[model samples]
Target: MPRQFPKLNFSEVDENVRLLAEKVFAKVLREEDSKDALSLFTVPEDCPIGQKEAKERELQKELAEQQSVETAKRKKSFKMIRSQSLSLQIPTQEWKAPSVNPVLSPATPVLPSAFLPVQVPYDVPEFQRVSISGDYCAGVTVDDYEQAAKSLVKALLIREKYSRLAYHRFPRTTSQYLCSMRDEKWKVEDEVYPDFHSPPEENEDPYNLDDAPDNLDYVIKIKGGIPFVYDNKEMMELNEPRSLPYPDLETYTLDLSHVLALIADGPTKTYCHRRLNFLESKFSLHEMLNEMSEFKELKSNPHRDFYNVRKVDTHIHAAACMNQKHLLRFIKHTYQTEPHRIVAEKKGKKMTLKQVFESLHMDPYDLTVDSLDVHAGRQTFHRFDKFNSKYNPVGASELRDLYLKTENYIGGEYFARMVKEVACELEESKYQYTEPRLSIYGRSPDEWQNLAKWFIKHKVYSPNMRWIIQVPRIYDIFRSKNILPSFGKMLENIFVPLFEATINPKEHKELHLFLKYVTGFDSVDDESKHSGHMFSDKSLNPDLWTSEKNPPYSYYLYYMYVNIMLLNNLRRERGMCTFLFRPHCGEAGSITHLVSAFLTADNISHGLLLKKSPVLQYLYYLAQIPIAMSPLSNNSLFLEYSKNPLREFLHKGLHVSLSTDDPMQFHYTKEALMEEYAIAAQVWKLSTCDLCEIARNSVLQSGLSDKEKQKFLGVNYCKEGPEGNDIRKTNVAQIRMAFRYETLCNELSFLADAMKTEQISALSK
Candidate 1:
């Protein structure tokens, strides 16, 4: 029999737990001052009396445990098991890649498995392994250990549920352990991954619309914020919607509250804090001992190194995809060649490129990277408003609209040309890819159709680029201007058209074609802005949210997750590509934002706030959720480069990759992605193996199709551990891979053991 988990109902939860969640929400809202908010999320510099007392008490408890004979015996046993169970070795046989057809509708094509057995050319040299021979629960009490493990496992289950519902990727290694803890068998067929359409072949036309599936004519309605699909208008009138799995708001809130309460739990925090420290120390020991051996292994591998490894710029904005210098050059060249070409209209008067510059009292010839004023500086630090203004060239919004926006008098021709130039450079590099975000403000239903028309008209499709749709969280601004009636309208305008296009592709051919290259969605805005509203079951639904006040970050994430979940289920049935909710989270916000993202996002960008919450950080590590970090971007907006946590997170075994958030503002080179890597490698003193490993993480986190990933990373890239790594292709050392794999397994084994102990205790009772 399959294991069944208990259902969560908000009303049935303990009152104390409910109050704790409320307290967390209230605390986040109350922290309006930047300094106070920062302190609330980060470790306080001035240790309070309560914290000091707690530390003293913990030290006394540790001293007492050191003197206990039973504790000593338990420690010995743990050491013996640790050494015997975790002895690392190279595999003699290659594992075959599993056929992962995540969505199996009749219209879906089954692609063949890309895996093929290949012998490793060089053996991974024997290296020192860090084995903890002492009590695994040395830092915390056994009771505390059990509590942390239970809470963590519960959190993973919550994430896995959401991931599978949306066809998101969850690590197979973690899934197997989860299955074992539940006393069930884990099968490859149970794994679900997001389906991304492969790029058109060289002989095929990217703009061909004849291949769209026949129209199903399904009816879609957004009653509140969630979409319901009906077979036809008759089914809709009868209120008989399709049998797609829709998320329940109450259940989601209950699960969210559970995670919220766990973050504040004393025992769990203590356990997680200790484990994170241990992970960092373990990596240090491994590096000191196996550093040379890992390098030696890399030295023997031929035709691959850090420079040649495929790296994806997983987080970048389309508006600022090019560097400031590139933008300046493009502007000058346009003025030099097409000065008489009509490019814009003001007050219904057509204006040429030269005339627009003349109206601004400037000449394109005089514009240098410095005079452009697009680059961010010290003044922009902690000032999102200032950073946003940097999007405009020379403090002029006219230039931005004419050059950066997708809709303009010239139909974004100038912007498309710049983007294509960037893409051409990437093609020349042959080892880089990017997922640039284009804005979809959800102001009207025509936004989708217009954007699709712009895409097709400009012929902006690039093999080295995958597009992401970013929804700016500016509902309050729109509501204030009376541009939107309610939040529900906004949600409808954003998603309803996509649902229609999916259900009737022939009628929406342009959108249907354009969506093939879009791989994910991103929620982006200034996270530091405070919204006093607390999201709960009692809060107003989207349709009734008529006030000018904006909802909180959690509110936005939950709704986005819901729509994406339902949309993915609908598309899966039609054999269509799905979207991943890769939100811009934890950049600079309340810790609660990270909590919401943990359950909703497939991965997140700029997770600097994780450093403050050890519990969430450990959970992120356990789940192996990929994070795209941009230190230069942070330096100009939130944190300093020297204080960035990317290096620390990397050392602690987090799935982190380097990204250039906005090359125009934060970078100074034509090869923006390479500039990002070079700076990170130099500042962090990263090794070749470290750089390659990060590059490998980027490919896995990106929206590239499975066929492309296999060609780049290796056929068995889907597998975990050293077996998954192909050094000849990835340039990552197997020794490093083995250490990472063993460490994760060791941590997971502890959780599995704790669950077993709980089961045994229940049986005894």
Candidate 2:
């Protein structure tokens, strides 16, 4: 007979059982019987005596055995959910058991392995994809969160739809739907190791600023300033710039060499196929593709001329870099640090850089912007938003339930710090500010309040820091709550209460009256605004809005206009300026939107859509509005001619500053800003002066206070008693000042070049 041990709470043992254990249990149940120390839950084998107890123990053993057999049976016949390879014939969808787990939220409890009977495979093509129709951006109410839930589910479903579609169309069209994979594998992307920055504490209160790490003093990359360069040989090699159609190293334009080296080993595992496809379009690859006819015989691996034929996107992370011949490896082995030097020497006969290129199956040609468009869909941006992903759908409701499960899973502090960390990285790179300033795009009031609380906490943690938190998706909250008519009321209700609850006047004197902190939406344009929920219905709301009558189809415009007015009113009443992003997409109310927003908003995000209207650019320049541009994000998503209009806008003198908009999605950081700056600089061949002006604009137009701005503008503030006058100087020395500014520019350029030389030398050493 199989022996079974029973666990017992000695204090609660049956009287008869207690009597039986009295002899030996005396040590466990002492005369001091104060606090029951018998929590170890052990039972004396010879103690308890009861037929009923023994029967119960036997019954439990039987039940456990039954479960074990059932689990074994289930495992023996598990069906495949994902196709490991992409082939001509499309795999059909199959039904599976519903997820018996509770809704997935940050707060949701983790389920035991036994509970998850179905071993759901990572995201693949056959799972029903989530799709939000054109109406998703229109509007919905919190009451309609279920409907909102469905739409959100759709958004989540399609998050990886591009991943699957990218591979479905084969090598020819695969690039269109492919996105960058964080890992080189076909499975779901794992979280990046050693997060860029530490996360925020769960309970947000009573924080100490001193506990935070000292922010390293940032110096511009110009001469006499500290050069911020990655010291790791691997980092330098992998990041050494190269492109498809491989441009000469001496060329000014960007190539994939650096980015690929940093992440990938060879041609097959770089960015999304779509990115490679975009690259192929940028360069005249006819000769190369034709020369590499042998590539057709090569299966799976990415030919430098083409891409991999997988339904899922793969990326080059620490894992992928472990294999293959990397051109950057020559640089790494010659320069890589002891940490990453563990990588084995090249497995086969090695070739030098030039020889490696000459040995490629094909010869590459020119790289130009002639037929390329940056506005095209970037299929690889899905790695950042994975909350709603739950595979193995049995039916529609279960899928909907799956989608609904991730509703509260929207990341808060982890995301918040990711932004902060990116800013920190930028601070070390080519950034001008001593402190990293960032602007966030948010949707709901709760998100706004939480951001506000986080900002205060961050301030309390590092008070001298400056952060511009803007909300572009504020309208969704109004629509979700069905308060379109009372949009102003909602802003007031959320912002004011949030301020009162989080802020301590006696403590944070710098932020005395914080109002109108967050601002914008998914794009409040005539066309897209009408996509989510109807903004009209004059009689639907009365006496709530200043304009009781909702004009036909202009809800997007009018709603933004009224909210701007109300937010401004709140600012005036409170007597302070708060961070606001007057974001308007497309040409709807284009001029009026710019004028009103510039007057009230401190800055504008992605306002480059006004490329069609030159007059707006003139007004934007005249108003001296700071336009925050996220180059990589826009480049990955929008068409070149329409995306940001780098040449025209900068030429017109809009106070332009480069920012990493949604860095995680774009894989950008402070240093990445330099990449975008490099792209703009190379494409337009922007002069060093232009780069200076752009850097100046970012510092001057930043959300720093006037006194702090003055402090920041002080030329030799970082040095001890160095000779330099105030930038605002106006005397006989003004002429000298002009020469100094010119000198400063020269110094900066020299320093940048020297930094590069110094870094390379340091590593080469």
Candidate 3:
């Protein structure tokens, strides 16, 4: 009924209303006929339109929430942009080429007043070539001549000790008196089928008849230096070895000619003795008998060669050891010819057997254990046999004393400065012109290039003094990080142009010195070894240099050697080097820093000695220390193990320094490290004086100028007057309080006493 009513009104409606009504009518008609189209306007028949709209809203909300969650997640996950500063500018100029200044000649420093009026020992041209013994020829005594003669006699006696009586049985050459009697008597028989005719016996003199033989015998004697003659035969048995005496050899004036005949070509012990006897007889050379005293057991072999007091090029030390008197005699003789020559020239020519024997009797260089132990080598002379693996022991308390007495004068601050100076020397380096010129073991080429570029940029940004970076490698394998940039192709843009502009020819020496200083291979390992620079091209697995090429010019090595000797002596005197660790950082590392460092005294000293080019001295000194302390030959791993805490170095008498080997990398200025040491020692229960000694040793081991050394020894730092004792006393008291150790207190007392004595000595001087 409602649809019929709407259809009747559809055409009668106004235009706007009629269109609406017609649309309504058409919609009604379409809805009535089309069941599929009716559903467009209707929600699900089972649900209300409001409910459907609510569900649609819920769906829209869900979609919006999902998009919001995704948007939020994206925002949360995005990373922030980052920017870093890159320094780039003029390449490092330290490696730059030089330009000529206004002055064309090289600059020279004027001699200071102290160095002026220089006097060298002698000029090469004005020197004479006089013989060493020429001036002292009259110094010999009659006793010397007698001793020389006696030496020859002694040799003859020794030969006679082995002689035996020999009787040749022939048909009795001459039957003196033969009698034939019928009752009782003797009969004489003749040979050759003929009756033997005997000469009548002659009556003997009453004095000689008692001992005279029935047969004819003869005796002959000659004056001094003469030969002997025997019965009817010219048997002048010379005192020569096994062979018949020189034919017709007869002595005359104890001349060199007669002695030369016996000793000129023979290896007989008598050769040198005979020659010495002749010389003594002629020159009276016994007055020059100054020789080193040696114990019988410790005495060196007597066969050592000694030149006459006239030879040149004689080593002073050898002379001191073998025959100091002879050396002095020679020196006295040559004083006029080359008065200024510090040492005698060694003669390459050899001595005769007689000469060898003469020295053997005197053995001037032989050092007895007693003599050397007390007065020459350290009081404690320890000889280690490398062939034997026995390790000599040192007491802990003794080592502690040494640690307490080390040199602390350089202090932390000045020590840092010295390190800084050493590093500064490398600042002026440039890239090497050669390929692979840098170390393969140090910073790699990439690292260096980065550094170079960074350095240039840094300089441009905030130019100041150049960075004085120290490049000392800890081990041989750590040298791969020292490369410079190539032309702009790699290693950032900074290295190439910078290297091209700054590099020069003469700078190679500086580079080498710097590299050597950093790499710790400036010298050879030993004189016996060779440089074999060829090793530079191959893998660095072999020994690189010998001790000869890298001689120690500094006294640091000597000081270190002395320290080791001192430690050994102390151990023999007292007991050990130390018993506890100094202050430490944390609980992680071992508490053996002080002990390990103390043990390193030998190695450190060895390194220092290598600087001096005294391989013989080094070896000699090494022989004086225990083998356990030495890092010789191929025993590095052993040395390292001995240094380790796990190894428990039972033998502990060692003297060492806790040095700031490479302070820059440790982020410690020398002074700062020292301060830390002081703090740590307190925390770790270490002795104060022990720390002081470590500081002192650092200074003592330093290569400081003499004036600097004086300052470091506390000679100049203390008050000028005895009245200043108050301050020193107060300081000592404070240290005692802080350390609270009796040993430290005792060391301080000793130091005070030493200082007083030193001051007194200085005043007297």
Candidate 4:
């Protein structure tokens, strides 16, 4: 036989039975152990222990599974919430379920992938195309139809009952009958009942007495297959667009409360359309419509030919009253055509009106004397205000913000210099002082103090030496802040010695000693050109010095001349120099000499006009002429000198192409000197190449080196100088130089022929 199935032991037969026994036993034990235990549900004390234990274990397993499922679901929900929150905060993250092993329950519902609120599309034709009548209903359902029918019924009932009419008395019983019949069936039930439908056969027939209501002569058709009665034909016709329910006033006053209620409860656009329609019906809205149209046009891109538009009352009002372009154009047109109509000077008038009107081709007479008088009363001015009164007020905080924002846009050095210059200007204006002579031309003490303070406050680090020099003069009082010791020392050391050298040697003997000490020169000795003394012997041979006799002039003159030469040389040597040594200073000197010459030539012996030395007088004229071709023989001493003495005097601060030999040693009358110089140049009409070489040599001989001298020579001094002086000097110089070089020998040959015989008699004498 096959192995028999395991015999069922009745003592351990059912597992569920065993668990239930154990649960009963446990409950009984628990109730015995504690007073607050669930006594009502306790099992007997004799329940099987094995059975109770099995039941407790089974129940605990079920509870743990439930809690696990709940916790997992909660965690999933938290992850979804976190993902949603993170999406809002950082929009890049995609939302997803958090769990790797999500066990979906049968009861749990799935969510949609995305959510968005619903909205009605407004661009549909029906939405934009507003109609005046209820006959045209957009997107209305059956409910809308029922409501319109009810309103019509109500309006008819009110109309018929209020007025004494036989049809009205028949209406209540008839209406009830009709309602009952309608409730029963849509079609008429009574055999005697009239059909509730349109008069299909009659298209334009006159209304019948029965079809109309009491006292109403005409009826208007509505959208819901209903009709309204009006006392007057005009009222019915006027209500044709809107299908107004109660158009007959004498029969019964129309209750517009329903219309208002509909509007209050309707869509905003719907209400707006109806309101607009009402206004149009009540008033002449043409002007308002035009204004609206103009507003739209003005807000769009501007039209160049804005004046090409229709003009009427609305246009005139817009032109006169509005600030918009269309209005301005209209006003301008009106002013041009009917100037007298423009009451420009009225209290209500503004300058914009005046401006617009004046800009047009209007007749002035039309603008009326009254308008002119009005404008005169207001003190109208031609100049427009640079700043607008509305936007550019002084107290506006936006102005300060703008200034702060734009502060960086201004270059740092420029701002500092501007402030310093403004301070100087203020001081100068207050004192009314001229330049150079600080005592005579400088500011008063108080002004100086203020200026110094101002400069100190505004000063910043500067790379320029000229600005560096100005700082001390403007900010002396605030030395700690404004003056840098190193820069101040440089100025003091260089300028003091240089200045002392030029001091009156007779008055300041110590200055003379200081110059010698500073420059390491020997003591100076007295010498005179008349006594056959050369400047070389009298003073240690200085740089740029020649063995030629010293011209009869003051030592100060010689000193200044030397200093100028020194400055010029230093500028040539230094790569970068300030704009200080310019034609202004050089030309100023020339002007000084020329003015003196002019005064002396005119025999005006004013102390200021009379120049002490004939040498300076000659030099002044020489400054006006070419220095290299000077009759006084241009040899080793004058070689490379190209600067014209006449040009120098006429202009100023001209770079010497070895031209600044000695300002003091120059002596000769400008005219006589020019005459002699012209004789030589005319006699030696050299070739263009040779004359160019002479010019180049003169420029090269200037205090500037080859490169710098070339620059100064390249720039036409006569042209670069002041106005009224020769700016075309380059062309003239080129022409003169070329003529001299091209025909020097030829001109010399002709000179003998040109010479008069009278000169031979003088030679014989």
- Find the candidate with the highest lDDT and give its number: 1
lDDT of 3 at 246: 19
TM-score of 3: 0.19
**Candidate 2: deviation at residue 587, Å?**
8.6
* Residues 411-455 of candidate 1: C-alpha lDDT, one tens digit per residue: 999999999999999999999999999999989999999999999
Lowest lDDT block of 10, candidate 3:
80-89
CA RMSD per model (angstroms): 6.1, 34.9, 50.7, 54.8
TM-score of each: 0.92, 0.36, 0.19, 0.17
Candidate 1: clashing pairs of residues: none
Task: Give one digit per residue, the lDDT tens place, for model 2 in 43-160.
Answer: 2222122257754664565455435644323222211101111111122344353354211111101111111222322211111211112321112111122222222222222222
Measured by TM-score, the strongest candidate is 1
Error of 3 at 703 (Å): 3.4
Q: Please provide, for model 3 over 629-656, each residue's C-alpha lDDT reduced to its tens digit, 9 standing for 90 to 100.
A: 1111112211121222111111111223
Q: Give residue 598's lDDT in candidate 2 (0 to 100).
A: 32
What order do candidates take by TM-score, descending?
Answer: 1, 2, 3, 4
By descending lDDT, how would the candidates be arranged?
1, 2, 4, 3
Model 2 lDDT, full chain set: 0.30
Q: What TM-score does structure 1 among the candidates reach?
A: 0.92
Poorest 10 consecutive residues by lDDT, candidate 4: 310-319
lDDT against the true structure, per candidate, is 0.85, 0.30, 0.21, 0.24
Give candidate 3's error at residue 584 in angstroms: 20
| Candidate 4 lDDT over residue span 1-765, tens digit each | 111111222233233333443343344234334433112122232312226665576456545644564434433443343343323221121224424421111110101121111122111000011113222222222223223334333332332222111100121122332233233321222211111112123353222212311121232222211122343567666764322222221111012222212212222222223222332332233222332332232233233111211100100000011112222233235445544433323256533323533444343335432322211111211111211111111223222122211122221222344333433542333311111101100122232223223223444211110111111121122334433232223223323332222322333333222221111111011110111221211333222222233322222122222223333222222221211111101121111222212211111111111111222232222122222223222211211123224222212211121121111112222122223333434544422222223334332222222232223343322111111111122111222221122122111111211122233223324
